[model samples]
Target chain A: MSVLVFSSLLFAASVAAGLLGAMTGLGGGVVIVPVLALLFKVDIRYAIGASLVSVIATSSGAAIAYVREGLSNIRVGMFLEVATTLGAVLGAYLAAKISGHWIAIIFGVVLLYSAISSFRSNVDHLVPIQPGTLASKLELTGRYTTADGTHAYSAERVPFGFGLMFGAGTLSGLLGIGSGAVKVLAMDQVMRLPFKVSTTTSNFMIGVTAAASAGIYLSRGYIDPTIALSVMLGVLCGSLLGTRVLVKARVSMLKQVFALVVVVLGIEMIYSGITGRI
Target chain B: MRRPSDHELELSVAGMLRFGVTAAAVVSIFGGLLYLRQPHASITRFQKFNAGGPGLRTISGIWHGMVHLDPRSMIQFGLVLLIATPVARVVFCVIGFARQKDRLYVLVSSIVLLVLLYSLGHGFQ
Candidate 1:
């Protein structure tokens, strides 16, 4: 295909991914990277580089809205950031040494795991557990209102969550995806935050995580200006539109659909990675 | 009832400008280095500078140094400063609104400004 045609297709695919991602609480990075690598024949490194930029764009775009709406737990995000940012830096450094195939395989496995987890899980509406020690001292717990009503939540297991965030950050840097699935898992399972709070707070935290590695990637020459700029701009616009749709979206159905889609993509990635085609 | 002095406003504006300028400067400086070292084949060169590849290094060096930072770090920083100016304006507005004990306007305006800023920063750019 001509470069213009190829770019346009990528742009449309990114927008679709952003739309699905926003609606279902998944990050666009997961969907974009594999598609670029497998279908478009883009190099995994370049795809990853572009994915990281889009992650930043989506998170920054979504964060502003979530924060202002008082849905995001800013303190939770801030506390967790220490872990994710450090992990991202380490991950970016590690990514330089790792093979593209290994990275692709890992990404595929994680995507599959997240899809299954999404399908099996239930959205808990319980009040979140309070933060202990320094976390509590920092005033990290807060409440947010959903369509149903106002629900208060708290954060716990600060050390564990932070540690997990570091791992998530590493994966994010390595795979060029937002690592939101891992962040949500850390916040929801380890920290025991409610789904809403965990998801929103994860969204709030992704930008910083992405930014840390983005600098590394930029210096490493992975980021293509045209590709990065186009994907970022496209995802940002799509996400803004998606956020509006999110307010009115039937999230349960969206989650199921998203999970199914991710499973397919994950399988495709695995196949391509093993075949040495991606 | 007291108000923030003009000096306070100046200080706040200056602080925002400083931060924006600093971030842009850092990006530009690294961007320049990436541009300068694009032709080299050394992995250490790529590692030290953090260039992803030759193409990225070339582009960032050109884009950031010329379009984004040509005038100076201060100029690039000014763009950030400009982006944040409304935030400072709104904080003062809210403070003034609060002083009048008209809490409603402050709440409404704060949310409005937050949404506006969020959209502008995230959407068009």
Candidate 2:
């Protein structure tokens, strides 16, 4: 296809990906990679680079709200970033060494996992775990305003949470995704943060984590300006629009539908990877 | 002077991020338009893996291209800005942590910053 037609189509696909991502809280990177590689026939590397850019766009666009809501723990976010950024560098380095097929296979598995997890309702438990010694020393405890009142929570299992964050960052760098599911798992389940805190903090950290590898991608020639331009702009616009509609809409059903879409895409990616079609 | 509360610090970071993302988006759109205006824009240049042009591989190259109105470089410059936004946030946090008289978090933030700068400076080349 000509550049105009191709860009237009890619932009539209990215918009849809962003819209679904915003409504489902999955972020746009997951869908964009599969769409670019499977439908547009773009090379996996370029697709990854482009998808990572859009992830940053959507994350930063949503940051203002998350920060204003007073849920995201900046101290917690900053501390864990050490692990994530380090892992991001490692993942970017490994990307060059690994084959595209293996990357696709791994991405498919992660996609399936995230989609399945999204189906489970997050029941926020108030039974606070005791903060670790490191967490206490570092002051990694805080309270957030709930509808009823302010609720306090503390960080637990700091080392384990940091390790999980490193794995999340590695997956993010490897697949060009936000890896929000893994991040939430680390913060909410492992670290014992509140649900709102976990999700918003995960959102808060994604941009920095993704940015760690983006520069590497840029220098290494994975980034295609034309592709990234369309993808980032389209996703940014779509997610920005999606957030406005979100307040009025019920999203539980929407989440399930998007999860199903993710499943299909995950299967498609794995099939193509196994068949060497990508 | 009193330390900045978490709420105030978050507000500042939020404002900074909003501005950065907006500026990046505007620059990217401008670059995209210029790119589409070129005669050669009809041809797609991304089918295979190539190391990209000199104009986009380095920060100085991007600056030189922007001076010459090169579309790809302009778009890449915008992307570089986007990448830097998060790094900037980390910097902001470091300062915030310091202002709180929290030496441990300042150290933590600095380590994260160093890793980020290292990645951006060069891949494991």
Judging by lDDT against the true structure, name the best candidate: 2
Least well predicted 10-residue stretch by lDDT in candidate 1 chain B:
B40-49
Which candidate leads the pack in DockQ?
A: 2
Candidate 1 residue lDDT tens string, B27-82: 53444344433443332221122433332343334345455434222222222322
The TM-score of predicted model 2 comes to 0.96
List residue ranges in candidate 1 displaced over 4 A. A120-134, A144-153, A251-254, B1-55, B58-60, B63-125
- Error (Å) of candidate 2 at residue A34 is 0.4
Q: Looking at model 2 chain A, which ten-residue stretch has the lowest summed lDDT?
A: A125-134
Off by over 4 Å in 2: A127-132, B41-44, B123-125
Clashes of 2: 0
Question: Per-residue CA lDDT of candidate 2, range A1-278, in tens?
Answer: 77878889999998888888888888778889998888888888999999999888888878998887888988899888888888888888889999888898998999999998787678784535355577777778888777799777789888999999999999888888899999999988888788888999999999999999998888888888889989998998888888887888999898888999999999999998899887
